[model samples]
Target: MRLLFHVQHFLGVGHHRRAEALTRALVAAGHTVTVASGGAPVPGEDWGGARVVHLPPARVEAADFRTLRHLDGTPVDDTWREDRKQKLLALFGDVAPDILLLEGFPFARRQLQFELLPLLEAAKAQPRPPLVATSLRDIIVFNKPPKRHEEVLDLVNRFIDLVLIHGDPALVPLERSFATADRIPAAKKAYTGFVAPVPPSTPNRIASVVVSVGGGAVGKALLWTALHSRPFTRFADQPWLLVGGAMMSEAAIAALRDAAPEGMSVERFRPDFRAVLAGADLSISMAGYNTALDILQTGVRSVLIPFAEGGETEQALRAQLFAEAGRAVTVDQAGLTPDLLGASVNRAADLPPVTLDLALDGARRTVEILTAREAAR
Candidate 1:
């Protein structure tokens, strides 16, 4: 089966990375996969054998997430949107895939309706329209107005054939974030569990505390607080590794590196982040989907400061859920100070690692689900 996967990540790389993981899984399962990325390319990322299609990349200009800009930091205009829409349509016509997977639309990425709405219409117009599915993470942003939910439900019912909720229903249900989840037909919904890389066998546990931001786009506050709070923590003298995400500017990384005290070190990114988590005494990071999965896989004692800028509640909700499960400690961004963060770090260090029993085989399960759907078709 040929699959065309569309993903757009404006603030962080987590969404695109998860989509790429699934694309690789599909390719491994004997399906030809093409990934259409609508965001700026993540540096040093390899998509293996999957064909990559680069759309006119755009990113959020600020925490508000209302303004978008091209990779060159220029504001996106009407002409650019039209061009991107046409290119996306052309790609759809060229691929003619067996399955059309939208990473997030209707439910989220409402900003891209200029292109996605037409893309959905074009796919349905096909004589035998490919199975259209919406691939979403565990939680969604719930701050939208009631009418937004209605619009999403209407779109899902009209165009989408399946809704792949990438999480365990037993752990966190879609309805927890999306109020209109029940409106979508049961036959169209499937919880495929969380997607994450398998843990490495031998982890390099060189650091006592591991701090990271998802893409480092909006992580300055967290990183600054963590850096300043180290002296107040119990493990003040221990090695603290701070990872500035790929999206972080070189100037920011250099500044952080210069500010590092005796035992603290800073770097741009770490490919073996999960492995480092496995060997660390405590994990400190924002509560994004992929990072949450990594922390769960390692079962490391953790302190999660969910990124809640721009009225985004998904990460905060995820942090709350994990905290309620006794899997990690949560500190609200509003209350995050050096002293508070340092104290939380000490408290988290005392807690034992709790092994979560949720499914981590989403990549394989996704292929199985798609293959079965294709066979039935």
Candidate 2:
């Protein structure tokens, strides 16, 4: 099957990463995949064997997530939106994919409705329309008005053939977050276990503490707090690594480097992040979807401060589930203090290996679902 997948990540790269995992699985299963990305390009993302198409990039600089700009930092207008929409429609015609997989469409990415809604219309108008589906994470940021849910329901019931929920329902079901999820017909919904990459497990482990901020755009508070809390923990004397993403300002990175409390290293990126987490004695970070999945795969002792600003509730819900399962220690992002973070670190360090009874083959399961749907269609 030829699969054309579209994904856009405004703040964190978790959404893109999840799409990457799914496309990789599709490629490995002998299906061709073309990933159309509209978010600002990630420097060294691995997409297995799938081809990539980067649209006119747009990103959110503020936590509000309302203002969007291009990679050149110019504000996006109707012209850019039309250009991107045309590009996506052209790609659809070129690929003529059997499966039109959108990472977040009517369910989220409401800002891009101008582009996606048109693309959806184009796909349906094709000679033989592709199997339209939306690939979503376990949770989403949905504190909007009632009409938001109504719009999603209308689109999904009208166009989408499948709604793949990439999560284990036993941990956090869709209804727990999406109020209108129950209204989606059962045949249109499927839950693939959490999509995660398999990191290399080594013969030995590193004793250092690993702290990472996904995308590093909204993590200055957490990063600085980690530095201040270092001296209060048992691992204070041990080496620590602080990884900020490309989105972090150079000034902030430089300041973090300048203010290092002695045994901590600061950098912009780490290609082997999963491997680093697997070796770390302890890890501290925000509870973004991909980061949380890495902790789950590595079973690293972790203190998760879910990013809760700008009406984002996905990470908070994930942190809560991890706390309930004893997987990690969760902290309040708004009331984050050095002492508070230190205490959670101490508690997480003493817990047993973070074990999960949930299935981690969401990537594979997603591929199966897509192929089955395409065959049946």
Candidate 3:
């Protein structure tokens, strides 16, 4: 079957990561999958067996949606959206998907891309092809007011075919924010578990500690603390590994590398992140969904420093949930210093094991669910 996957999240990597895993699973199942994304195209060589199309990237700020400008900061208007919608219809016409899977923003986009629903409706009306489904992570960061929530509910009720929640709903329910959370009708909702790839164990050297700030976008402060703060006051002598995500510029990476402690090593990006993860005795990271899940799935002792900006608290909330469960440690970004980061890392390192065997199977379950839906249709 031909499948189409859509995702747009400018704030974090959660949406992209979930979409990537699902598309990979679909392709592995012998289906042709096309990814229609609004973000800059992922490095083409890296997409691996799926057709990827890029539309202009966009973001919602202060309740107003603006088209992202190129280097000059010029405001490009709604024409970009119109162009993308036309491209999507043409692509769908040419590829003819048997299933259409959308990720996030139905109730969350808050009318930022209200046109997406109409496009979906148009797709459904064409040639009677493809089953429709919407996928979401376990949490939704409610950055707007009650009126936006109402708009979200209205969109979800009218267009979505199925709801695929990536995390266990028992732990985090998406509907609670809506006054009519329980009343909103969905085609079906299932917890597919957390989608994380397992790290291989065969050839890497183990490290005393691993530190990473996801994609290096919003966690610069955490990296600075982890590197500059002395975390080894307890151990007296433990080496640390730092992974600055690709988003960090070379100059920024160089400054961190130059200031590194005698036993510490710093790199811009690690292609084998999971393998690097496997070797760590302890990890220091921001509490992004995929990063947190990966650390938990590895059952590693770690310190999670959540990056809190404005009123968005998704990562902070997620970290708190895990910390309460005795699985990880959380440090607030507000007062978090290198000394505090070190202390938290040490405390987490000393804790007992947190099992993650069940969480690692999220991707397979998601594939099973999507495949079952296709079969039923």
Candidate 4:
């Protein structure tokens, strides 16, 4: 089967990592995959075997999203949405994949992806490809009542064949995020277990606790608290590693590097986060979908600080849900303090780790949904 995947999120790497995991799963299950992204491409390497196409980058904060802006505060708009969709259709015409998987924003991107109309039309015209699916994580962060929810719903109603939600319903409720479950006409929604990518190596020895604020775009409060807290060295033997994401300015990185604590190590970024995560005894990080799943997958105890920005508190809610279930600890962004973070980190280290296998079979599950739809056709 041939599959096409799409995802966009600029504040962090959650979208890219999740899409890459899905693409890897599909290709590993013997399907061809291509990723068309509306976000700036990461500098290195192809994801699994999936071919990637870069479109205009999109950024999200809380629940609202828009085209990336220039330093001059101008919103970047290139008539590229249509151009990319046209190129996507041409690529679809070439391989005519068995399925097309849209990652976030098909029923949620608002008016940004107006070009999806043609792509939807092309998929409808195809005789062999019987399924068009949309994949999403457990939670979605939206601030207001969806402004154009019904319009996007119409497109999904008309074209989508399946919805693959990557989360356990027993834990995080999808209804809190996406309220359209009962409205879709011709699609099926399945709650796949949390999809997490496994890191290559499991470290033999554990030393310091690792704290990360994913991509370091937001949630500096968490980092600041974790860094400034004096009790962090209570474990005196256990040190700390802080990862500042690519979005951090050189001056900021230099300042952070300069302000390093006795046992604290600071860096701009690390490509293989799984390894970093796997080696850690404890994690202090923001509660993004991919990062949360990675921490859970590695069975590392964590003190999660969810962003308090405008979005409907998806991460905050997720942390609450997980912490309530004994999965991990939760710290709110507004309430975070050096004392609070340090104490939580120390206590979290003593908590038992829940070792969930990080390998997600999203591709095979996706193939089953797609091929089954085709066979029924």
lDDT of 3 by residue, 275-322 (tens): 767677777888887888767766677788877775666778788877
**TM-score, one value per model:** 0.98, 0.95, 0.89, 0.85
lDDT of 2: 0.86
What is candidate 1's lDDT per residue for 233-307, written digit by digit as tens?
988989999999999999999999999898898989887888888899999999999999988888888999998
Q: Where is model 2 more than 4 Å wrong at Cα?
A: none
Error of 3 at 169 (Å): 3.1
Candidate order, lDDT descending:
1, 2, 3, 4
Q: On a 0 to 100 scale, what is the lDDT of residue 92 in model 3? A: 72
Compared with the true structure, all predictions reach lDDT values of 0.89, 0.86, 0.71, 0.68
Cα displacement (Å) at residue 371, model 3? 2.3
Please give the range of 10 consecutive residues that has the lowest summed lDDT in model 3. 62-71
Q: Which stretches of candidate 1 lie over 4 Å from their true place?
A: none
lDDT of 4 by residue, 1-377 (tens): 67777666566667677777677766777778777776665544348867777665556553444544533345655564555667667776766677777776564555456666677788898765447888878887654456566765776678887777788766665677767655665347776667665544655323367777776767555666777874654555566777777666677778777877677778777766667777777788888887787776667778888886644477888888768767788877776778877788777777765654333654456556666765676
lDDT of 2 at 354: 51
- Tens-digit lDDT track for model 2 on 1-377? 88888889887777877887787788999999999988877767778978999888888765667777876667889888888889988998899988899876787888888888888888889889999999889897787789888988999977899999988998888998898799999999999999977766561344478889998878988999999998888888998989988778899999999999777889898777788888888889999888888888888889999898777888999999998888889998988998889889999999886577787889999988888888887
Error of 1 at 44 (Å): 2.3
Q: Which ten residues in a row have the lowest lDDT in candidate 1?
A: 60-69
Cα deviation in Å at residue 106, candidate 2?
0.7
Which runs of model 3 end up more than 4 angstroms from their true locations? 9-11, 43-45, 59-74, 111-114, 127-129, 175-180
lDDT of 3: 0.71
Which is superior by lDDT, 1 or 2? 1
Error of 2 at 206 (Å): 3.4
